[model samples]
Target: MSARRILQLGNPLLRAVSTPSSDSGECERILTDLRDTLHEFQRTRGFGRGISAVQIGEPKRLLYLEFRGRPYTLVNPEWDWRSEETFRLWDDCFSFPDLLVYVERSCAVRVRYQDLCGASHVLEAENDLSELLQHEMDHLDGILTIDRAIDRNSFCTREEWLRQGHPATRPEAFASKT
Candidate 1:
């Protein structure tokens, strides 16, 4: 499978709402392309953790996220559960190119999705991987993190993100109890 080119911000595809997978055959191919695209981003950007089909100009409900060494595919993925606890962290997207923004998301989430074989699976995720999955899954639903950013002023370049204290804290809005 060939790696697909990523669609940057302002691309219409990134704004298009992706449709869910209809059958097993279509899902298999999308899964392969998703895997290839995930690898391509990691290789070129040196730090892509997840990507959605919409980001590649495909309006199919497919996404891939790399955890450790394995790439996990989530087809028609949705959050089945989310914790009241929330976390704020730095997030960047391939579509947005080089901009990084501090954003808030659920600290722990359980998602349900289908695999290439059409088998449904529920996954429990936490920490950065949890955030990565939710971020990409949002793309499938036509949601971008920028839409939920706590501070529009918090937007910055990757270098700026480094210049800040670089502390990982709960989202300012969530008011988590430590």
Candidate 2:
């Protein structure tokens, strides 16, 4: 597997819901590509924690994440629960790296998913992890960070956002988990 091109904003395929993954081999291939692509983006752009297969034009229900030195591959994930209390933050995406959007997200979440080997596992995430899960999950359903923007004014260019000292929405930094 190799680094693949990330689907940018305005791609029609980014608007299409991804299909559930069934083939383990294909899932692994996509997972590897996702890992490579995410790392490359991180190396060059300096930030990115997770990526969905759909972002690489696969349109499969798969997500790859590297956080705190741990790597996770989630296949056909499902939401177990989400916290009622939420927080707002400026979110960004590989699909539209130049734009930042203010959005609200659950403070915590529990998810169930299978690994590349078909083993089932559950992940209980809070704060940063919660937002990362929510962000990648949105891609499987054809949703983008911009789509979650709180309002018409909830937008800013990367340079402007940086120049403005990266406006904070809460105690956390104004960065999308990915």
Cα TM-score per model: 0.88, 0.93
What are the runs in model 1 whose C-alpha is more than 4 Å off? 163-178
For model 1, how does the per-residue alpha-carbon lDDT over 27-52 read when each residue is reduced to its tens digit?
77767787887778777777777888
Clashing pairs in 1: none
Please report how far candidate 2 places residue 140 from its true position, in Å: 0.2
lDDT of 2 at 143: 90
